[model samples]
Target: MNRTMVTAVNTLGQLHKQVDLIGHNLANAETAGYKSREASFADLMAQQINNYSSAGSEVGRQSPLGIRQSPGARISQTAMLSKQGSLKTTGRPLDIAFTKENQYLKVRVQEDGTSQIRFTRNGELDIVNAGDQWVLATKDGHLVLDENDQVITFSGKVEEVKMIQPGTLEATMDNGQNIAFRLGVIALNKPQYLEQMGNTLLGLPDGADNNINQIYSDLNGARRQEISLQQGVLEASNVDIGKEMTDLMASQRSIQFQSRSITLADQMMGLVNGIR
Candidate 1:
């Protein structure tokens, strides 16, 4: 294959990948708490061409062989967007939104009712009948617990789960009830580095100190703040549809341009081959 042609083909492949990513972002634009990813492009190695050494003897001699450039740019990484999405309101008591400084709720999720705890910020709360009482749950249908508690799945509908401020609850009910939830205090020194476990929960990542005091600093005070849990209001998704549409158009155009370039290169190659 000709060097330039090979490079163009590689670039075309990268563009296709980028288009796919853009399509995905647009598709999930309305999904609750969905984050958009951006594709990153990187140039392939550049070939050093036309080395001109201007010493007295070598001034006039121009090199005929040009250094070969590798195939075009490639899609490198899809960086995750950490930007805060705009919060929309739906008036429902279970629908709680986080206004706190980088705090999320912890809930239990599973294929069955027996799944482990995961973290999420989709803080729409609900109630489930955990055998005896009702308990709180996060949106996306996870049962919220006070501690690492098991969920009591019910065959019927649940009613009356309360949303206390975060850090108020010491333990949670198995059926999404907040019986133990009360005004309380947790003394954590380094709360900022909490690892995100999907579904409104945070935990100590492995090889890190679970002991809150090991990371405690007098300057780094972990003061308690109350999270307002609005009853009957849910937080809507943060995806910006306008931004996603713009990105989709840009990716589509780039793909089309690359496809055209490849087609033109192929036509030129065919002409050369036809020459007798």
Candidate 2:
């Protein structure tokens, strides 16, 4: 009976985490460029006990001559879904949306007093003043980088900026000087290796410096693959609230069922103790 209770308790714990993950998805349903995560469950180890030594005596047995006691179930792994979201036209020139789901924009970030490179799916752009010059950046204020790994900077009031090609920007400066910049974008063949840095920022793993080139490919200039991009547009969050709600209800039911099993185990224990 105690073992039964333990198994139910373990399953309940895993169910709780699954519920929390569902809640997170629902909360981010309106967040721009947010991706949903999914969890998979697996059964724990089981102990098999043989009940009969002579199989010839139980020739008509309908089931196996053994009892299997399983520890419980657990969340095996969680995977991020990288499907492209719906495109929303914002009518703002800086707003950009990547039709390719695997593409990410390169941004310069300051973390722990150290400058580092990060990647993001968020396309909301802003121009911020950095001392003597103004640089293009994300809405979060992370400086956007060009193909040369440098921040896109300009002086004086920005006259106009347009997307001449996929991931390429053309800006007309105040002095009527037209300059073209190819935005730095990387195609992550396997985004599962990326380390989440919060606020939609992702980075390479702790020691993946050597394998970055092998796993990710730069999409710029001649190496640039055909991409569908649109300026003055944004990508909405890919989360589906209806599916998330259904998953939430299912997880809640699992929790309730596990609790009932624990209750039944306790009642069984009481009945056995009362045997005279």
Candidate 3:
């Protein structure tokens, strides 16, 4: 295949991948606590020619110059945008929204008989009966964990649940005992390192520190005062429909132009071969 055609093909493939990412962002525009990803492209290194000496001076001879050929563009990386989304009031007691950035609620999930800790921005939760105890759970039934990294359970029937302050919850039981538990709200050191675990949940990569110590430090400092949690509210996805539509159009146009370039390259090759 011709070099121009090869380059065009590679670029077209990258544009297609970008189109897929845009489609994904559009699909999750309404998903709560969803973060959008932006795709970046990078060009390959240019070809270089070794040192050409001008000692063999031929009159009116031009010096040999290195050829800068672009192999093609490639999807360098897809980075998650950390912009905060708008909050929607749901008026539900279990719904919560974080006013601070890079914060997430911690939850525990049972997979293959083993429990794994996961982090999520979605605060829609409910109460579930796990055997003999009633524990706070996400909508998907994953147990919501407390600061101790243990499942938060009510000692008796929960009569009322209220947020006394950010990262703190107070509940009144039917037996007249009021229990207060600190909500496991944590700030990630590097949220970009978080891996999406489906259902708007993110999991810490293996070997990556949970950053629990950082959370503790923040709680002890004045940063804790900046963290605010709003009950009865949920965060909407941070996707802008207008921007996504513009990106989709641009990608489509680029794909068309690349296809035309490949076709022209093929035709030029045919003409070269036909020369007698």
lDDT of candidates 1 onward, in order = 0.56, 0.86, 0.82
lDDT-wise, the better of 1 and 3 is 3
Q: Report the Cα lDDT for residue 160, model 2.
A: 90
Off by over 4 Å in 3: 50-65, 110-114, 210-226
Q: State how far residue 21 of model 2 sits from its true place (Å).
A: 1.3
Q: Which of the numbered candidates is closest to the native, going by highest TM-score?
A: 2
- Give the range of the ten consecutive residues with the poorest summed lDDT in model 2: 220-229
**Candidate 1 runs further than 4 Å off:** 45-70, 100-102, 111-117, 129-135, 145-159, 167-178, 182-232
Looking at model 2, the pairs that clash are none
Candidate number achieving the greatest lDDT relative to the actual structure:
2
- Report lDDT (Cα) of residue 102, candidate 3: 82
The deviation in Å at residue 223 for candidate 2 is 2.2
Candidate 3 per-residue lDDT, tens place, 1-276, comes to 788898999999999999999999999898888889999999976676555546555456575554457879999888888789999999988898887778888899887899898887788888777777789998878888887788899856788788897788888888978898877767776777777787477876676665645432234245556567899999998999999999999999999999999999999999999999
- Model 2: how far is 31 from its true place, Å? 1.5
Instruction: Residues 1-276, candidate 1: write the lDDT tens digits.
Output: 766567777887887887777777777666555556778899898777765545775656575444556568987766555455566666655555554333345556673555654445565555655675545555566676543344533344444444454544323334565444532122324554455443234455555655645643211123444343344444444556787678778877876777777788889899999999
